[model samples]
Target: MYLIAGLQPPMDMRLFLHGFQDFFPSKAWQRTPVLYLPLVAFGRMTPMAWEELDQSLYTLHLPTPVTLRHTGFDVTLKRNRIILEATMEASVIDHLSVKIRNLAQRAGVSATRSLLPSGIPLADITDVDPSVCNLWLATHRHRFASTEEVCEFTVFKTGKNRENTFQEVMSDYQFADLFTPPSELL
Candidate 1:
């Protein structure tokens, strides 16, 4: 199952912190693989006010980017939408669903305070063609020109299935420590 959320600007560290700070103690968790594309592509695909937010927000320094490793899950930014692509594993899908829901809830709270015009929603979950994931992996692999795109690319360590916690799922997928600060600014 794949879950997606359309987000516009003002989407800085605060928004993410609102959604996931409790679960992810550090900014490292935001380092999940991301693909950024024009906002128009997303607005054309969905009925969202993608153009309303300040475009400068996208330029803000986000957390470090994790290299694409052909992991079963991916988070893509097409215009304003954050597309979460994952395999059909129940635990994996469920964990991601909760994450998205948390984001939506937090976004809603912020919206009420007029932090932004509107909040992002957990748009939908659908069955995507396997080729979509394959294409993403292939494109990222080609773009980064890295042959060592495996799940264990990070340095974080974790135990296996300890109390069936979210950390356990992250550990199993080798995503326990997704963020790595770059030694030099590119």
Candidate 2:
């Protein structure tokens, strides 16, 4: 978990029309182990521009700050055996996959491993509607012990009108391996 320093530029629709040219790295980017979250109000002004994303994460809040219960890391240690598993929320499946792909390309793991989103269980999965999808990061072996792996998902919004539920939502951002410890992307 990382602290969101501050959003440099207030969210603007201009970000969508242009690629990542406008996104100057927020102060959060410079921090070590940057799992940095963005300010909630920043997410309200714009929606996720999936097409323009590169090596960063976009975020929004629904009045209520999204709470994350660290179920644990992607690595599991059992009998000196390290097992890696990444489980994503149902709504974030697509974006998470993109980050995984980007990290795979940069990390050179694309060819060796098959990054996939499985276990279609709806329990932990909830519709994060009105709560926009923004926030990116890479999940890779370098972040874990030598014996680990990963799986992921995108949390989705439910069918109910969530306008009243969430106050704001983030647009998007790229999750990267570098965000993982030990500076994997480095």
By lDDT, who's the top model here?
1
RMSD of each: 18.9, 21.1
Candidate 1, residue 95: Cα displacement in angstroms equals 15
* Candidate 2 lDDT over residue span 36-100, tens digit each: 11221111111233222222333321111122222312322334332222222233433444543
Q: What are the per-residue Cα lDDT tens digits for candidate 1 across 1-186?
A: 111222211224224323332343233333222221111111111113222222212222323222222223344443443434321112232233233334333433222111110122211112334465455446543221111211221011122311111111111112224355466944
lDDT of 1: 0.26
lDDT of each: 0.26, 0.24
What is the lDDT, from 0 to 100, of the residue 123 in candidate 2?
Answer: 15
Off by over 4 Å in 1: 1-49, 54-56, 72-186
Question: What is candidate 1's TM-score against the reference?
Answer: 0.20
Q: Runs in model 2 with CA error above 4 Å? A: 1-89, 110-114, 120-186
Estimate TM-scores for all models. Answer: 0.20, 0.19
Enumerate clash totals for all models, in the order shown. 1, 43
Q: What is the lDDT of residue 128 in candidate 1?
A: 38
